[model samples]
Every structure is written in structure tokens, then in C-alpha cells.
Target: AALAGQRLDVAAEAASRARALAPNEPDVHFLSGKVALARGDLDSARGHQERALALDPAHSGAMNELGRIRLRRHDTAGAIRHFINAARTTPGEHIYSRNIDVVILRTLSRMIYVFVLVALLMLWVPAVMHVDRFPFAVGFGVLAAGAVASFGLVLLRLPREARGLVRRTLRTRRVATALFVAIGGVAVAFAAVAFVPPSELPQTLPIAILITIAARITATARLRSPVSKNQRPGDRMT
Candidate 1:
């Protein structure tokens, strides 16, 4: 109740009493860890959570709390390990599964930002240098291929369980259609640059820019939509 009310001091007091009464109980330690986390005491939170896990090796709650602590500390990989353990331990828990998606989406968001910057640089540098059309077309084609390969590699590197989820998401009609259009746009842009005269190469820039913008918008929307759906009301603890 105190935790729900945002009263961290009261929650900590209650948690301490519970821990004293049941020192061996994993749930008690989990509660204490949550209270410590609420108070912004990450070290205490981590210690309590570790203690909970030691008491019960299969304690999914402890694993999930530890994941939260890791996330707070900006340890993305550590957090992912903990979350994956939690999900693997309790396969029926949708919350644990959602946590994995949250982390993956966050990583994808960062990748999108980097991809956009690199794509823009690829487009801008050649134009500024007044490179010939054929060379620019070849460079752009290479960039596009590299981007596609990098995205595929990221998916392939995901854990088997997560890889299945991502593959399903990509198979959705909307996402697949968007990807097809984006890829097609890039192919057409390359063809235009390759066949068109050097003076006409500038005309393809706007189409390329539009494709980039569309991709950013589509990716951002897709990333954000799942986050809202994953959030559960009144899920304050773990």
C-alpha cells in the first residue's frame, strides 16, 4: 500500500519488518529490493534482489527486479540477460516477455538513429564532392545493401526466442509492405543515378530524402506503439 502511494520511507519500513520476520523468504527480499529501488538506492536494491535469487534460484520476480536495477544503471546487456532469464523461468508471464521487447525496441531505436545519420551522410558527401553519377550510384547501392545486411545481422544475433518474435513482427503485412516499398524506392533511386546524366543526378535526391523520412516515421511509429501496449496499469512493483 505504501509503495503504491509513492511513500518510499513507509514502504521501506514495512519491507524491513517483513524481511526481519521472514529472512529466508524470497518474496520478502524482493519487496525490500523494490523499496530500495524506489528510494533510488540501487546498491541496496541489487543486494536484496541478489539475496532473493540466492534463496530461490527459480525466483522470476527477483530476476525481473534485478533487470530493472540493471536498466537503471544503464547496463543494457546485463538487463537483457536478467530479463531473458525471468522470461525463460516463467514462460507464462507476459510481463516478462514484454520486458524483452522493450529492451529490443530501445536498441532498434538507437540503430535507426545511426542508420539515418549514415544514410544522410552517404547522400550528402557525394553531392558536395560533385562525384560522377555512376560512382555515386554504386556507392548508394552499396550503402543500401550494407544497411539491409546490418539489420538482418542484428535480428540473427538475437536469442532464439526473441528472434522468433522479431521474425513474426516483420512478417506482419504492414511492416512487410513498408519494408518492400523502402527497398524498392532505394533500388529505383540507384537505377536513376546510374542511368541518368550527371547533371540530372540531383533530381533523385528528393526521392531519396522522402524515402528516408518515410522510413524514420514508420520505424518510430512501430517502435512506440508496442511500448504503450506493453505497459500494464498498477504494475508498480516488478
Candidate 2:
């Protein structure tokens, strides 16, 4: 059954028939586990699925089901790992894509909110009160530093070996990268104008525009074409 909530008896019968037809088939065992899961026999479901996975490490279905079970049990990190492995094996399934996307979107949203709040604090805390002699410089310096760090983070590829770290980084930094780039550009522009001679402002504006253009072009190129050397699309596999 495609749906996981289907009748277990029916699924079990089907799995039995399948297993009879192909004894030792990993998929048959996997199907039996799905049936058990539908019947709310989690322990049984896990046993069958684990057996299936033991038979075939790359069994995407077993991996995904294990991921689902782990998620239901509140093992979010472990569940994410299983899901990531399933995605890596199949790389083209809609279910796997959706799972990863859901995880990533939720994590990114939370991180973005926190990063924005922090950015505001960095900009406002010293400048509004004029506590420091170079309050603007201190604030803008922090902004620029954050920007560079955030940009570098986006460019870092997700490590297949470090699934948890990669997942968290990808999930949190996806949209945060773009936002930081914009903020970085503005900060750079302000810094240049503040420091550069008034006569240089005309030249500085063009350079700032050039920087913006370059960043946009870089981002677009990363998106529409094959990955450039040392760079990848935000959502691409590492």
C-alpha cells in the first residue's frame, strides 16, 4: 500500500504473497515491515525493516521507513540521518526530496529569525547610545564580520560524512546566505563612503554598484549552470 495508514491485515497478506514469490527479497521484508507499521506494531515493523536493511544497505524504502519510525519516536537527528541516507541512495525520489526540504525549510526559518535579531542588536547597541568614539565603525565592523562569516558558510559544501552537521548548516544557512550578502554589500558601501574622500564618493558608488552586480552574477551563475570551481547551488548535494 502506498499510504502508511492502510489496513495491516491486507498489507500483511500482500507481503506474505510477495515473500512467498521471492523468498530472500529485501523488498518483501520491507513490505512486511510497512504492514506491521500500519498495524501499529512498531517493534515488529522495526525488526523487519532492520532485517531488510541488513540484506541491502542501500534499500531506500527501508531507510525511509526507519527514518519515519525514528521521527515518530522523537529522535529527530537520527531520523534526519536516515532520511539523508535514503536521499543519497535514491537522489531522485519526491518523498525523499520533500523530507529533506521540510527539515531544511523549518531549520532555516528559525535561524534566519535569530540571525536578524542578532544583526539588529549588533547595529543598534553601541551606535544609538554613542558609547564608543567610533560607534558607527564598531557597529559596521560587526556587521561586515558577520556578513563575511555567513557568506563563507554558504560556500562551504555539505559534507556527506557529517550528516548532522551538514544538515544543520544547510538548514540554517540556506536563505541566511542571501540575506547576509545583501547586508554585507550595504555595509561595505557605507564603510567605503564613510572613509573615502568626498571626491571619491562618485567613484565609490560605481564600485559599490559593481560589487553588487558581481555578487548577483555570481549567485545566478551558481544557480543556472553547473557548479563552478569550489562553489555549489544552495540546495545541491555536496
Candidate 3:
């Protein structure tokens, strides 16, 4: 009941009692680990989760918690492994599936870092060739608009319940905010290109990085879709 209610203090007391009563019980260790996680003792949480996994090797919940802990510690690979294990061990568990998708997104983010570098290098062609400014501006605007459109598409797929919170965040000035940021990004790009020396000019890289980041941010925002071998579909709940 305590765990269900997310009353971690009460759950901790119950877990302590359970551990005393059944020292070898995997569930007790799992409960204790959950409590430690709630208290932000990641090391303790990880140890208890490992102990639970050792006792019950098929404990999907323990694997799920371990994955979350690994993510907290910035161990993306480990997190993905544990999350995959949990999802494979218990395919019906929503938490495991959701977490696996999230871990996959973290992995994709690393790939995007490389993409940013390459895309920036490609952008240099336009700068070096002295491409017509109007055409270059049009191309950049199209890319930016595409990124924004992707974000809007992703937003449409959000759960009905979550839309409220996201809408609240957008408020009534989102258009104004987007225009301000877009104009500012364009101004910065122009300034960098105009002021930086030809031999030393590396403005394309930064501009490419910014554009790629925006594109990938939209991709990240769409990550809940379960359209892959290891991915699970979003839950249909309020």
C-alpha cells in the first residue's frame, strides 16, 4: 500500500520490517532498494537492487530499477542493457517498455552528437562557395521550419492527459517566442559569417550544430513511439 501510494517514508519502514522478517526474500530487497532510490541514495539503491536480482534472477522489477539507477549515474549502455533485460523478461510490464524506449533515446542522442559535427562540416560548403545569401537564407529557414513542424507532429501524439501540461507550458506566446529565437539565430549566424576571417572562419560548424540540435530535439520529443524491434508503443492511459 505504501509503495502503491508512493509514500516512501512509510514504505521504507515496511521494507525494514519485511527485511527483518525475511532476510532472504528478494521482494524485501527490492522494496528496500525502491525506498533507497526515493531517498536519493543511488549507491545503496543499486546494491539492494543487485542483491534482489541475485536472489531472483528473473526479477524484472529489480532489473528495471537497476536500469533507472544506471541512467541516473550516466551509464547509458548499462541502463539500456538492464532495461532490455527487464522488457524481455516481462514483456507485459509497461514500466520496463517505457524505460527501454527512454534508454534508446539516450543512445540516439550520442549518435546525434556525431551527426552535428558532420552536418556542420557540410554546411561549410555554402560559406566557402560564397553561396547567394538569399538562397542560403531560404535553405536555413526551410530546415528550421521543418524542425519546428516535426516538434508539432510529436506534440500531436502526446496523451490526452499530458497535453494539458504541455499546452500550459506553451501558453499563448509560443509563436512570438519562436519568431524571436528564429530571428536571433539568423542574426547570430550572419554576424559570425560576416565578422569571422575567411582563413579562420568556422561559423558553419556552430550553425550546423545548432540546426542539428534542434532537429534532434524534435526527434527526442517523438521518442515515445514504439516502432522498433526493442521499442514498445506508448501506453493508452490518462
Most accurate candidate by lDDT:
1
Of 1 and 2, which scores higher on lDDT?
A: 1
lDDT of 2 at 175: 41
Per-residue lDDT tens digits for candidate 1, residues 93-136, read 86886776566666656666666656656666555787776677
**Worst lDDT 10-window in candidate 3:** 229-238
Badly placed stretches (over 4 Å) of model 1 are 7-21, 38-42, 71-78, 152-157, 174-211, 226-238
Q: Give the TM-score comparing model 2 with the true structure, all chains together.
A: 0.45
List the global CA lDDT of all models: 0.72, 0.60, 0.63
Model 1: number of backbone collisions: 0
What value of lDDT does candidate 1 attain over all alpha carbons? Answer: 0.72
Mark the 10 consecutive residues where model 2 has the least summed lDDT. 229-238
| Candidate that beats the other on TM-score, 1 or 3, i.e. the better one | 1
* Residue 166 CA displacement from its true place in model 1, Å: 3.3
lDDT of residue 171 for candidate 3: 42
